[model samples]
Target: MQNSSAFKKRIKRRISGRPHVFFAVCPPGLSGICAKEVARVSQKAEEIFSDKYNISNINVLPGGIEFTTRLKTACLANILMGSATRILMRLATFKADGFRRLEEQIKAIDWELYLPSQTLPDIRVTTHKSRLYHSTAIADRIKPILHDRLFLKEPPRHYDVTGSAAPPPQTLMVRGENDRFELSLDMSGTPLYKRGIKKKIVKAPLRETLAFAILTRLDLSENDIIADPMCGSGTFSLEGAMMQCALPPGTFRSFAFEAWPGFEEKSITHARNRLMAAARTDMGVQPLPHILARDLDQTAIDHLKQTCTRHRVFQRICPVCDDFFNMTPPPIKNNQGVVVLNPPYGIRLDENNDITSLYKEIGHKLAADFKGWRTGIVCPGKKEFHALNLGLSTMPFFHGGLDLYTAIGVIGR
Candidate 1:
């Protein structure tokens, strides 16, 4: 990539300088898995963009990875970061011990770099252990400077902020900790989790980013068959097909960077062509048979069918309406493959609920029918997990505002 004269010229003409960006990985449940996904993709990024944008540094944050790369590499990071929630572009970082210092730092950073005069800026701020420790105070301090410097319009709030007029396409976040100030622009507008195709969601649907992480644990091959027996709205199966086809997860969505300077349609088209081309080339194996996905509810199957078709992944997934506990894994060329399940996790589920019996039956089916098959379950707690009684190596992670446990092991091993 570094040797490509075309890429070089694109860099010079489009992204003439370096821009720092970071990945916001999700999983209110487990930061470790997020780390693993970030690490895995970062290596791939190095292999692709190493010539133009070597990763200068990597630091672990509460729910993500803070890493630095050049301006030209942001699109690749967004396209490739499977577990990220948002890729924030670092705009400025300086000392801010007080309000005056904060104003100075904001003033020194060029707001026009990302926010065009016609665009609106949404600001979020957090402060800790410094003279300016109040988050609202910090936001209040920075608002006027943004308007005065960039000629930007502020979204007026009345009874509610959402009631405010919808702005064009930009947001700013200011963070301060221990007298250090840093500003980052949201490069991924809708948070990487929302691809807009997961509309048939059931209660407590698995976040796509977290689902991708679970699918990654399998170390899959083209020869391996992938199935999600409890596939509500088919997140796991759809994600698996996308991974197999080497499609970018954000293929259908627009990004915040597209509205910024030097990121015209031509540049975006160039980057997308290169990224998709490389992905296609690297995917050496043939796409597998339809990803096996089943759910008890016929409505869910119907919805999964519609959603998958909308996302253009319908052809790759075979949706069935059968109860997971009552059914066996579908026959594939490989008798031994993998089954991933997302069961009910009601925070209010108690001893009176049917989950215990459901999990027990699920375990019974796995032992009786799915011998030698790899199994993974996203369950709520020890009660449901122990019900499986499969002695699965566990990975604890959170999803959809709920804490959950993941268990994976070979069935009847």
Candidate 2:
């Protein structure tokens, strides 16, 4: 019985309670919006984790957030979150008053947590605001401490470690405020902003997160037919199509967490399987509804087509190169669809500072031609949307770092 108990303890140590920390970074102005998204997602995470593992402690932090989860729950996050950029496992957090203390705290961490057991570890350091302002100086100070702590045969030597057989972890994110230092291991090697598949970008492209935010705000669903006039790079259209189909946004990209220790291949596989299972074969509603993208620029249309191809949603969308006003909607049996437009603000088309004439034309067309349809227009400013005279409630939305409004007009009495 004693031997069996010891054996169980060892097994538990190997497989139980492995905690992971995640950090979600966003653009400066979008932090509050990102925070709200994080809160909603974390709530869902807590419910899922609690139901599965019978645990419930998810923490939200400023500038980003953190949570404690075992290996499987961490994998669940990668599959479930639309808002999170990357997941980081927290090694340790220490308080440091000065350069000496900071170096000592960094060195004291068990390098084995991050380094391979067989190789001599390489280290990199970064600092902000604290006394150790020079990142290179901080890196220099950290090497000897690691050497001493690990009890290496010889004193440490510095070498350029980039792409080395064992490269140091990409960064040691250090932030200093109020005379104290906070250190974190950058688990997300690349910024979450890079969803990996957006290889071709248009001029003044919208970030994926911002695109998702707009979709969320609009309360879009899979059943709705979506159209994007002036669809630069097809971001809104592509994101909308993917969302409607329940496809994972990260399906095309590799995540930072995949490279971490104890991350299970089976869990990721299962998540992907679940996503595939939920994916719909027919993105269009009955009678083959249209998800349309129209633009005046032939180059923009070509770019949109290429982007749609990369996203594997080319078949799901109909791309046309023509003026938005002249574009016609598909005649689907009896279902109504939404028409969305991201028109050029005065900033892009400098020839038109006072866009009242453009807005008036849009209003006239919608009020006359597409009377029964629902129209959503995204404009650079609130006044521009009001100028459209769509006779509907306007909800403010953010697009590409600009404060915009999405005016929803239900055409026809």
Candidate 3:
């Protein structure tokens, strides 16, 4: 429990590196794709920084990917990445075998470098196989020390652990494993899946991240047409538009790092501008492929229309109010494109709750209309996915607390 000068130095060394470590939390079963996106964003960050910002140590684990880069680069990564759930930066690490050691080490670290004036940390603590096992107790011990450091310049505000007050700029993760602790700051305030544009949703709308993950598996490109026959809320269509246009996913949203101490506002702005410029340059004179968003529900079609118009991709997306069974592919050169389907599952079933018949009908319809075209369908399980009978490869993933599989393959292959 001794807070020696050596311990203070160790903490400083852990937190003061010019190249900070960051982890991109991804959806389960999609970490490989997320890692690829992170690497792509890292290359873009290097271009934006215009300096030798060495991005290295990209290690892909089960649920996330870890990498190291400059702080500004990490902020740009947060904006440019498409598949990650969020990004977190490792702030400090120390060993604290008991409450006294934890408290002493917490007091030894400098907080002003990370926290702005008059700000409090929203601490989330978790402990496993450690002496300080109570998460609430550890958070309680650490909060007052952070408060004392952050409120020195301004009047202290009342702390509310219930979160009735406005959300703090940063969320501090305090993870303890076997007497060792790691402190990480949430760089993205909201989860990356929340693209912040769709104001309307139908029953059981697909998540944006899952949509993007499926699109990635299909090798989607700007030249390839996208058809979402069961386009509920048009998540797949919207994500497809963003990808085709090379638009940064976080452009319409703000991040938690924007309010942190010593955030390079100018640099971040420059990076965004540079990304937009590159997108514009890449889209010169070449028309984006049409994304046909079709559904039987007129209300769903109307909502998709509004969203596409609001996002300024209305021209690129053709919203049609027609049953998928009665639909035909638009006149393209070779009908070489991708068809995505997120039909009803679980409680959103038909009157007889016969999903197999519905899936079989869908498979027949796609086989007839979209021959040689790639198709992706999200189903509740392998049993339902197999009902499609498209010979599509299946991958398991989780969304909305349900185990799901996306069937992917070319129709009539």
Q: Among all windows of ten consecutive residues in candidate 3, which has the lowest summed lDDT? A: 156-165
Ranking of models by TM-score: 3, 1, 2
lDDT of 2: 0.59
Q: Rate the local accuracy (lDDT) of all candidates.
A: 0.69, 0.59, 0.80
RMSD of each: 6.5, 6.7, 5.4
State the RMSD for candidate 3.
5.4
Tens-digit lDDT string for candidate 3 (1-413): 11346634543454334788899998899998888987887777767787776679999986799998878878888787888899999877999998999998988877766665577878999889999999999999999999878876444323222122444356899999999999998988778887767869988888888898999899888878899888979999999888887878876677777766546677787787777776632324777777888888899999988887665654588889988888878755554698999998886776677888888898889878888898889988877887888888997889888988999888887
Candidate ordering by lDDT (highest first): 3, 1, 2
What local lDDT score does residue 374 receive in model 3, on the 0 to 100 scale? 85
Q: Largest lDDT belongs to which candidate?
A: 3
Looking at model 1, residue 259 earns an lDDT score of 56
Error of 3 at 201 (Å): 2.6
Residue lDDT tens for model 2, 1-413: 21256633643454334454546555444455555654554454455444443223554566555555565665555555555555555566666666778777776675533432233333445455565566676667776765555443433322221112432344445555544655555544555555555547667766566666566655677667777777877777777777777776666555434433334555556656666676764534453345788888888788777766664544677778878788766543233666666677744666845576787788787776666666667677766777777777665645556677777656664
TM-scores for every candidate against the unseen true structure: 0.83, 0.74, 0.89
- Which model, 1 or 2, shows the larger TM-score? 1
Query: In model 2, how large is the Cα lDDT of residue 293?
Result: 83
